[model samples]
Target: MPKDTMTAEQRLQTVIRLGVPDRVPVDPMIYYFAAYYANITVHELWSDMKKYEFAINKCFNELGPWDIYYPINPISPEAYMFILPMKMKLAGLDLPPDEINQVIEEEIMSADEYLTFARSKTPTTFLKYINFLSTLACRVQREQQGEGIFAKTRIIRKMLKQIPVWREEFKRWQARDVAVQHGICMEAPFDTLSMSRGLVSFSYDLMDNPGPLAEVSLALSKGYVKVGDWLTKKTGVRRVLVFCHRTSNDFVSPKQFEQHAFPSLKAIVNGFVERGVTPFLHCDGNWNKNLEYLYELPKGKVVLQFDGRTDIFRAKEIIGGHCCIFGDVPASMLAFGGKEEVTEYCKKLIEKAGKGGGFILAAGCEVAPNARPENVKAMLDSVKKFGYYS
Candidate 1:
């Protein structure tokens, strides 16, 4: 399998199918790093689509070749936010230009609201509540920061105009061998409830009133599957990224996770698998206690991506040949380590995790904003040096 024989997309797909490709596919989770490389503020990158395109294109052209490029920030839903009246700091309204917008976690819904939502059991109802909370969050920021309302309107206008332009750019990038992986983004049901209901309250509900929360989570899982199906049909991309934040051992005990989180998460994974789509689990936090549970999933239909907290070496030993695995390179190394150090670390990763043919080399999580450019290039270069299969 010579490197020249397959396109970057094909090379990646080969690994996804548990086959050795010409090289281990390099797909760093990049977002604000684009703003850093392009010498623009994160605000500017999200405020204008052209700047966003330029920043990402600069990364591909200057940084090094990438098998896949995430064209937009996962948290910032470009034009769709215009239709749904919600505001997030990631969209560049409340946060400073250089900083990534933080998720302001607050208990917006009451315990009774969970029962109400479950009864309604409609995606529109759930989203309306979320949007309401988001709108209130924006109002609070405006009052506290002394910001004006007109800025949001301007951002919305730019996003509407940029939609078509972004599509065209994606097509162009795909033709250039840098395929864009875009589809519906979802959070595990428990994580979604945590965001809307507040982690403190949700934890209590899991103990005091686990029945209602479990029912609501089941309903939400169905909604997520429907949204994923619609997005796949609309965009012709059969993939979904599911953010499983609280399911990790950092937040829940292994017993709690198995009881409260795993069922809904497995339901979501199974739903997507039944529809012929691949579910990429962005399992953040240290999930050491829960790694074994992943074996229950439909093998080859999931890509288990880890943050630095998860022991990816152990994960590879457990699920390497069963499913595609990506990541666990510490963000700290990329942000502060020298190029030589980064290259050495990458070699170690390839030797351990890249052994069985179903590994994609990536930064454990999103490349930090301050990660050295030379270190990133070293990551891409390491593939050529050590990622080949005979």
Candidate 2:
């Protein structure tokens, strides 16, 4: 067998820089499926950080080599609360043991509160002002709770404990020769505000009151560098997940996006690059129109990952040269299709999107909790069969 010329770290780095590597990097977003494959229950993962960590390591080692690992651990629900500030009902509580988490969006932050959150442009002040998520939960507690406005809340205490735990998880992925994905994650300020205000209320705000919304989002954009810095300090990894589910063209009109979303998006993306952090965009909807705007971001330092909703092939035609591309292997096929079907889809992606240097093969979204094991393997296998470079 021919030997790989670059390490996993080097391989991913090359692709992000828009340079050809030994092969197209493989980043299977193996999430809940890892637990099911490893015979661990979701409840166990929520209760024990050690078991959650063990399940992840076992999945990679036993399933064999996987290049970039997201390791979206099941234990820490608060990791997300800091950004979106919405209640997430995770599995093993009111939900079934193996079920995925759900976000319960309500009007947690009133239209009246927007001014205060937008003021400091600092999360420390904003989070204190917002006072944690509306439907707050802790896996350790397994019940709903509330926190009042304060200098510091219980969530900070919980997150501090998680830092040591998350650091070890990153180390384990490294031992397996897999480069861990973002050590920290971010959300577009518009998505954060839209969800926090509830969809109905947010829509009304968009139509009825556009001024404050724009002001707060742009102000929120200024603080992302500090947020990334703080998160990088805690996790000791430089890659950041800048998730964009609601801000895509699918969710809002182009005019609305241009006014409300784009400025903040640009600020945060550039903010990360200015601080020397790689921003991994987990764009979850049809971003066909938005792809045209991404070229303005720092070339070769940003990665755009789609969840099968966007036309990834056209995305390759569009920003494939300007930024590294990741994902679009449909979750449905991985769960219901045969290995041949999965392989053929991957072959197409490898041949087309993978034609150039800036692409990483990954599931269209999170690997479905029930994806066929053989199909998951096929996604990885296709890379070896068709992804080599001269």
Candidate 3:
């Protein structure tokens, strides 16, 4: 932790208090983006925090003008234990694959394979799980025959445990005064199950097998408590950001979210608030269907990180004062459009959401991998130029 580096605690508190920081928060999930820009693989970058830090700072210096930074965590390999994998490379993206451990393969299998997996404990599980999934997602344009090859069960459970380690690393960034936010999620139980089972199956399970799913929800809540406590204790930070990439109104019907997502999500949000930790939920899609449900989350307990699909003006009307709001710039507009377009979008987002002090200017999602470096610079500059109270 650098004495001069801004702490996550300070950034989060200032944001919640509706106070402008030295600059707007640039809390992006830049794992692959930063690594690729630095000519390093995500696996290598994550394994060596020093490289991860260097890559982030470099990106910030060359490309940023961001206030908050997210240190990348390697995807857990347990998720890919029994499956083939893929990756999502933009036009010119290139990175090598990291190997997964044999034990991870066993652990992710059915209960029948537990004995085989327990024989050996290795870091390879996390590596393999992440490598496999990244490989799988990357192959989306290639074919559909091997789509769900990475959807193993037990392995995902173990991967869930890795949340704490991820948080611990984010804490490291906070200590360095970079004020890192956890990627996607760490505090929401429903989002956790959705990530493990894929949004489709989990949605159906909540309707068809509510009993078992509820049991799983309870169990996951316990895990969230453990992870949240660990984050607070180790990081000594009061604010934690949880990105909701896939769990959005665009992904499922409102009824499905109410039945499958809200209960567990609320449980974890309440848990965080009870402990006095502020929560931020990133919804990277159209949330018009359930913005109210989002507000139903424990009041000030959660902040809304809306994506491009969400209407920032509507979001402000609904929960601006009740909770803080972050993000709304379209990644597409920023990546494929021009400076004026980026500037216009930023101006709109700020005009609509920044009338009050609770709004933060950021991308609706991550600044895309293939986004023009100049475009990213333009986007951040827009915030500085436009995201002011005056």
Ordering by TM-score: 2, 1, 3
Better of 1 and 2 by TM-score: 2
In model 3, what is the error at residue 46, expressed in angstroms? 3.5
lDDT of each: 0.73, 0.78, 0.57
Over all chains combined, what TM-score does candidate 3 have? Answer: 0.70
Q: Report the number of clashing residue pairs per model.
A: 0, 0, 20
Error in Å for residue 81 of model 3: 9.4
Model 3 residue runs over 4 Å out of place are 1-11, 18-29, 75-177, 182-187, 198-200, 243-246
- What TM-score would every model get versus the actual structure? 0.86, 0.92, 0.70
Report per-prediction Cα RMSD to one decimal: 4.5, 2.8, 8.7
Tens-place lDDT per residue, model 3, 1-390, is 112233445555566666654434545445556766777655666456567668777777797646566533544433222122222232222333332111111111122222222232434533332333333233332333333434333344545665566566666665666665534335254554444454456556656665444444544554465455555565555556665555677776788777766676777778778877777776767888878877676654467887778887888898777777888667787668987888887787767777656667777667775666677777777655765443
lDDT of 1: 0.73
User: Highest lDDT, which number?
Assistant: 2
If both were scored by lDDT, which would come out higher, candidate 1 or candidate 2?
Answer: 2
Candidate 2 lDDT, 28-70, residue by residue in tens: 8876787798888877766677777677667666664689988
Q: Which ten contiguous residues of candidate 2 have the minimum total lDDT?
A: 132-141
Best by TM-score: 2
